[model samples]
Target chain A: MAETGQILNLRRYRQLRNAVVVWLTLVVLGAFLLRIPRIHILEHTARNLYFHVPMWFTLMAAALVSAYHSLRYLQSGDPIRDLRAREAARVGIFFGLLGLATGIVWARFTWYLGTSLWWNFDPKQSFVVIQLLIYGAYFVLRSAVEDPEKRGRVAAVYNLFAVVTMPFLLYVLPRQMESLHPGAEGSPAFSDITHPIMRLVFYPAVIGFIGLFWVLYTQRVRLALLEQRVEMLQATMLEAKS
Target chain B: MKTWLRGFWAIFEKDIKLELRARYAINMLLLFALGALVVMAFAVGPTPLSARVQAALLWTVLLFAAAVGLGRAFISEEERGTILLLQLNLRPGAVYAGKLLVNFVLLLALNIVAVGAFAVLLRVQVAWPGLLALTLLLGSVGLAGATTLLSALIARAAGGRGALLPVLLFPVLVPLLLSAVEATRSALLVAEGWATAADELLTLTGFGGAVITAAVLLFDYIWLD
Candidate 1:
């Protein structure tokens, strides 16, 4: 606990955490209060774009952070970099699950209204589930290794591979298929189709969610560092006694 | 350069001789694939499943058989205590190439068996045998390369010998498998849909090339670790 600040730069973390709270508050307000033009079939449910889209953006941001740390781990062979990569992945997958749950709810009520179907095989949605499963295996792989340095090296390599697969799984392959979700020729890609008023909330929401991911990721890194220190201390005491 | 080729050949021949002696992994793969096809035939009951459904089923079975086939990529080395000695003697890249070649050869043969069963039992006809073979070739390259690396990674983990292979593999395989299924569908069933399938085949080739290239580059890290 005493050494945690040294590991995490506590002041900067606190500052960012505070800023994120206030920032997300304002984004939430804007999200609920902002007025926008409405259209058939989407109506008010279109507001979900702010919340749902940001989850994916945050997940991607977290993935990039994780992969960056993994690359550094491979280059430097640092355990701390391994810890950062692992925590960032854990947080990224959290955001991914949230995104999936939100998408299910949003789709069930909006496009799937009265269909009695909770999980229609939308290409993007199905592909995202696959993406999440890939990430899920990362943790399982982590759990299967006992040596700290070896685990770090192997998991870093695997993490690099996982992140490399992310773009193809999440976007490239799905786009090629006949999905009911737009992004095909007839529809302005979700980016071009949204309202200017919504952009006000959307941009901040993206930043805020990413900020939230950072705060959570940093928290995990600090805690894991503390745990590592305790293990070191215990190992030293046993060595001294022996 | 000569030594590198020699090292590669040694590993490739070792794996081939090992397999020939036991005839174990490939036999299990063929049996699993044939069993799955027979089960599907029973379940679907003679009236032909749609071409798309047939394609999906075939790819699914092939992917699973691949999982079982190459999941033992490094297990024999571990069991025989040769991994450390192999690492001492061979470049990791050469080791990767050999293992990948072994998987490629084994999976390519197993794939032919599975495809034959799909045609005979599932009553699916191949409209273009050459194109179907090409699609299988492309699909198996990615399959062999990826499973070889992943199996090696899993071999040293706390988990038993590649038990987690498919769990870690299937998601990453989706893109390759999807393209394989589509190309197979077009090559075997879809009249002149072959023209439209050019992009899918290209994607398959690129994906296979990228995975194999990356595996060769990165295998040293996990292997030596």
Candidate 2:
């Protein structure tokens, strides 16, 4: 705890946390209150653009941050970089799950409402699950290793492979398949049809959620550092006694 | 340049000879493939599933077979404690190339047995055998190269006692698998749209190249460490 006090800048963390709280509050309010031009089927749920889509954008940002840290870890062999990479992925997977859950609910109420269907294996939705499975493998890979240094190096390398597969899995493959999700070349695209009026909330929602990711990621990093310090102290105390 | 090629050839030949002598990977993979084929047939019965489902099943079995076989490349070396010896003898890059080549060739051959058995047991028929063959060839290369590198990563960690390989390999191979399944379906259909099949074929080729390129570029770091 004392080591955390020395290592972490409490004032900056507090300020960032406060700002994220305020920003997300505004986002939630705007998401519900703001007027969106109603499309035929989407109706009021068109407001989901503000929340559901940003979850993916935040996920992508988190992936980029995780990959960046993994690259740095490989370059410098820095344990701190590995910590940042792991924390980013952990938070990223959290956002991915939320995105998937929200998407399921949104699609249920909208597309499959009449049929009582909850999960339809839409191309994008199915692909997202595979993407999550890849990240889950990273966690499994980490757990199977006993040494911290070997775990970090191997995990970081595997993390790089995970990131390289992201675009092909999520975007390229999904778009190639027939699906109810957006962005087929022959159809009237979702991005094309979205009301410019919704962009007002949509852009801010993306930024706010990403800020929220940053705050959560920073918190995890601090906690991990504290745990490392505690372990070090325990080792020193045992040495002293011996 | 001659020495590099010589080193790669020596490692590759050594791997093949060792694998052939032991017959560990090939026997298990062939048995697994036959077992999966028989089970799928028994479960679904000779009902002749839709072309898409059939293609999906074929690719799924192929992926699993690769997972079971390719994962042993590094694991065996480590278990015998010969990985360190090999590392000291050959360059990391050469060792990587050798392992990948061995995996790619073995997987390609294994897929042949799987697909042949699949066609025979299920009474499956394809309109374009050439294209289907091409698809299987390209897809196997992509799958093998990627899995070989991942095998090294996992072997170095857990000593090869986990489901990490399949879980990791599946998602990475999704793009390739998608293209393969689509192309296979088209080949099995009576349709003659040559130009349309080009997209799937091109995607498979592009994906295979990309995976191999990435493996070549990154294997050194994974190998040396």
What TM-scores do the predictions have?
A: 0.95, 0.94
Scored against the native two-chain complex, candidate 1 gets a DockQ of 0.62
Error of 1 at A65 (Å): 1.1
User: Could you give the TM-score of chain B for each candidate, in order?
Assistant: 0.96, 0.95
| Each prediction's number of clashing residue pairs | 0, 0
Q: What are the per-model DockQ values? A: 0.62, 0.64
lDDT of 2 by residue, A1-242 (tens): 24345448888889988998999999899889978877777899888778888888888888889889988988988788889999999998999999999999999989887998998767777776876787788888888989888888888888887666656665455546566666655567776877776877788899999999999998999889889989999999999999
Q: With candidate 2 superimposed using the best TM-score fit, by how many Å does residue B142's alpha carbon deviate from the native?
A: 0.5
What lDDT, from 0 to 1, does candidate 2 have? Answer: 0.83
Candidate 2, which CAPRI tier? medium
What's the residue-level lDDT of A176 in candidate 1?
Answer: 57
The 10 consecutive residues of candidate 1 chain B with the worst lDDT sum are: B155-164
- Quality class of the docking in candidate 1, CAPRI style: medium
